[model samples]
Target: MTTTAVDPAKCRRCHRALTSAKSIATGYGPGCAAKIRGAAKTADLTDFKPAQIAKATELIEQGGILRTRRPNLYTAVSGDGNTTYLVARQACTCPAGIKNRACYHRAALTILAAA
Candidate 1:
C-alpha cells in the first residue's frame, strides 16, 4: 500500500484550506494554488526553450510513474533525470522547485517555443 500526501494541510507551506494533493507537491486552496501555480507558469519565462520544457515534462511523468508506489514505494524524484530526489505529497525533488516559487512540470511542455 502507498500513502502520498493528499490533504493540503499536510504540505510544508500552505496557508489555506487544501482540497487535493497530487504527487509529492502540496496544493493550496484556490487562492494559494492559483497564485503558486501562476508563479510556476511565469517561471518558464526564465530561460528554458520549448524542447527543454517538453523534456522536463517527460521527466516529471516518468518520475511520477516511478513514484506511483511512493509514501510506500520509497520516495524518488519525479522530475528531471539527473537527480533522484526524495518526494512527498508536499515537496518536490529539485531545489529550484522547492526553494522559491517555481513552476511544476505542469507547465513543462507549455513553455513558448519562441521563448
Candidate 2:
C-alpha cells in the first residue's frame, strides 16, 4: 500500500524516524533521497513529451514521488501539491489515469525503477 500523508519525522521509504532537519522537511532520509536522484539521472525520457519528461524530472528532484512498502507501488504528489495518488506498474490512481489517459506519474515510475 502507498502512504499518502507521510509523517514529517519519518523516512518515506523505510518509515524510519528521521533526526535530520533536511530529511524531515523532504519526507525522505538522505540516503533514500540520494538513491532517487541517482536513479533519475539514468532515466530515459526520449519517448515521452517534453513537458512530461520535465515534470517527471521535477518530481524526482523535489521528492514528489515516493516508494511505497509494496513492490512496484508508489505514491506521487499531485501538481498542486494538495494530494497524493497511488501508482502501480500498469496504472495510477490519478484523475488522468482514472479516465484511462496518460500522466507524468507513470513517467516518474519509469524513473524510479532505475533505483
Candidate 3:
C-alpha cells in the first residue's frame, strides 16, 4: 500500500512540529484534534445566519481576527477599518452585538476559538 507524505509544518493548535502523517494532513496533533472536535460538538450555531457564517469564514481566512489574553475575548478588524471585540458568552462591541443580536465578529471568534 502507498503511504501519505508528512509535512514540515507545525500544528495549528499547539504550534509544534507535526511528526505523524495524519497530524500533518489534518494540521493538528491527535490531542488537539480531539479537543477541536469536542469544542465543535459543543458550539452553538443556531443563532447565526448564513450570511453571518459566510462573513465570519471570510474574515478568518483573510486574517482579520485575533484572540485576546482573556479566554473569551477576541478582536476582529473589518476591511472598513472598524474594530470590534467579541466577548465569549457575553457580547460583542459591534452594532449587531449592541442590538442584542448575534454578530459576525462573535461568529468568527467562535469558529476560531473552537479550532
Number of the top-ranking candidate, with TM-score as the measure: 2
TM-scores vs. true structure, each candidate: 0.32, 0.64, 0.59
TM-score of candidate 2 relative to the true fold: 0.64
lDDT of each: 0.42, 0.80, 0.70
Residue 103 miss distance in model 2 (angstroms): 2.1
lDDT of 2 by residue, 1-115 (tens): 8879865487766778999877877777888888877766667755567688779878866788877789888999999999999998568899988987668898888776766
Q: Model 1 segments beyond 4 Å from truth?
A: 1-8, 19-26, 51-76, 79-83, 86-115
lDDT of 3 by residue, 1-115 (tens): 9999965777766789988877877666888767755654466767888788778766755556666777766777864866555555458777777899988778766776766
Per-model root-mean-square deviation over C-alphas: 11.2, 6.8, 7.9
Say which prediction, candidate 1 or candidate 3, comes out ahead on TM-score: 3
Candidate 2 segments exceeding 4 Å error: 1-8, 60-63, 66-71, 82-84, 98-101
Worst 10 residues of 3 by lDDT: 81-90
Question: What's the residue-level lDDT of 45 in candidate 3?
Answer: 62
The predicted structure with the larger lDDT, 1 or 2, is: 2
Candidate 1 lands at a TM-score of 0.32
Q: Order the numbered candidates by lDDT, best leading.
A: 2, 3, 1
